[model samples]
Target: MDSEDLAESVLIHLDVETLIPGTLKHEKCEISTTRKCYSYIKKRTFATFVASKRVSSSPTDTSPVWQCCDETFSDPSSVHKHVSNLHAEEIEQLTTAALDQMLSQSEEAFQKQEDPNESQSDDPASWIPSTSHLSEEELSKGPGEVLLYYSYCQIRDPKLICSWQSELCSRLHLTGKVRVATEGINGTVGGTKTATKLYIKAMLSHPIFKIMQVEDFKTSEGGAECFSELKVGVYKEIVPMGVDPDTISYRLAGTHLEPEQFHKEVQSLLEDASSKNDTILLDCRNFYESKIGQFKNCLAPDIRKFSYFPDYVEKNLDLFRDKKVLMYCTGGIRCERGSAYLRSKNVCKEVYQLKGGIHKYLEQFPEGFYRGKLFVFDDRYAISFNKDIISDCSYCGAPWDQYQLCSTDFCCQLVLSCSSCRQKGLTACCPVCQAKEQRSSSSPSPGRPHREECECTDSRPRIPNDTL
Candidate 1:
């Protein structure tokens, strides 16, 4: 349908009881059968509508203008028909983008009305400002710390926990992503050292999070500025393995190996060539993450997202049959569930996961078996410890590991381009994306490529031997 009609159709299905001000509601919509639709809209055309036109508080702007070509619809059926006939491919993304813009506008309005000393509202739909009001002196005193940690336990009130986390992080002047769910909490927040210390103290004191210990936190040198902004919300899954948590729970996870123990195991595997045939070092993270850095001779999967891990394992069952396996990720959360899935298959002789993932391992052994940089989910892109460069530039084949978003406006692919190639404007992930960038320069509005055609979405099994 046209942009205006699409927005109208979306608002009608928003299910206001479930749509909160700060969180994007992710329930499926019944509007379409072919695609999974959300109750909100935030995609390209709808986002433009939200930005240019303000929603009236009264009856409504019945004939609001839309960015797409001039069009008028008399009924909902006509709008449905128009949308199905034209924008079928992007229905899911469109709904997701719509929810984001709506939530953003609500957050902005909340900030304007918020009082620093006022008590927080218990309302589920209430939004809190993510930006902190800490003074410059508090934030400028010392080194910063980025904490990575996750806990899996029953949370009776995730919405309440989500609300408290937003306030806590904002008060400490922290930035990064925090996700809370019925299962537990997973977060990576960065801020001043003092603030981070206070945060850990507060978390340990909390009745629900008391199960966490200081050792659970994995810290690195970074500040709130390492991330673009603060984001705290509740979600379906803490790690998003795309499976029911009840079916594959962390309680069924494999043995947790401390840094020293894991080090000895890796050393033995590296020294004994014959052991390689019976032992497997598997990287549970996605292809992009493992590409920059991993333990020497590890088996890194070629999947793009964690949700695909179960499928990858099911298809490659024979690879792990009767073999002793060791798994790891950026932090340890993925392995908690990943190893559980692997063990559920009952194909391995024994399964083990690095207790704190690569973060803790790097702290104990900065120049150890793992090489290159650690890929992070923030504006900093990655954090490095050693001088080794394992991955190469996507364009010129020069040794490099730094990642930059593709220059193509509509593309989300991350490309590894050396400074020389970047200076020459070689930033696209592949030849297909580079051509799209050239075309976008001449057109005012460029259409986004289908996800199936994007290089970032490719799921083919990549040859692991070459990555090492």
Candidate 2:
């Protein structure tokens, strides 16, 4: 047999039950003491008996010889029997003693290492993740949360806050997007319950965020997995209203109405059909957002992005003229600046905003005027308050509010697709996008399908003066 094959046979026959004494030698922590001992003995025994028998300096020798306890054996079976009968139990006992000593020493070393750290004062800077010891599976199964919040207060250095947020999020093992601007900070982070709680506590302790209370954060079920990655950066605008913050300040935003007050106003509008003629319930979010969950009898714009809201308002100036507008967004951040922009036009009679937006409204009244799932920016896409669905699949006529990013390579449009269509692989947002994707697949190129913007992603006029 070949030398490699002989080595394998010897390893199979070697007695691995007995461990080497820890006092004999040091090995890597990853290598168990018992396994290390067995390895050492197997190497020595195999080299001396097996290798010497088959591969020898003097080509005349072919008999196996195993030496142990001042005696020798010519046959492999005899040597194995002798070791099993005479040495196995004694070796096992010795190894057990060595393991006990090693464990005790390890414990003592660990205590000595921890003593100095324990004596020091507890600081958040030195905080360690509590789930560091948990397995990936355990972390996934554990209770977690996603915090959606925004603060509109002036900051001297937004870059400093941005850097701090990046480091803080990394340390806490959080995953989500955080936009820090000179005006304020807006973020939606997801992590373990402990981590999210710690994040809220840290924010509260910061002087810049003193105006924010626990109520400012709208929390929902889900964890770090809800977000693909952690992105903390500085931006010119917190909510991207596409207007110069210097020109349209949130300080000039419309009057804020509490959830109850806003509910009453909405109920009054819904009860009286003629009241809606003079008063407008404007949804400040994008078409996709309001399409899934919106207040009854509200006007949801067909704008694709938040940046398009200003243009929409500019184009439809007559719609808001002499009308009382009630604006609301996902978490109230958009309405802060959106209302300011609308009021700036001086066309609207009065502009009021939902203090905490749909988030707070649902918290106080889950079965209130708002129906269906609340659209979110995270991987969750949407969180439901009631089973009511107000949107239909873009592909089919079936009612479905769940939004999935268009599968077209470069298209960013979110398509409302029912489970049946999705299962059939109808992921493209529109017919043009689906045709483009198909053409790219059958092309001569061999990489990911080349993609370009389609009509589905382009700007569109506002929806008809009707609530769908």
Candidate 2 RMSD to the correct structure: 30.7
Which 10 successive residues of model 1 have the least lDDT summed? Answer: 30-39
lDDT of model 2 at residue 23? 33
Candidate 1 C-alpha error for residue 53, in Å: 78
Summed over model 1, clashes come to: 7
lDDT of 2 by residue, 261-339 (tens): 9999999999998888889999978777888889888888887688888888888889998788999999999998899
Question: How accurate locally is residue 445 in candidate 1, as Cα lDDT from 0 to 100?
Answer: 56
lDDT per residue as tens, model 1, 254-372: 77788899999999999999999989999989888999999999988888788988988888888998788988888899998899899888778678999899998998999999999
TM-score of 2: 0.68
Q: TM-scores, in order shown? A: 0.68, 0.68
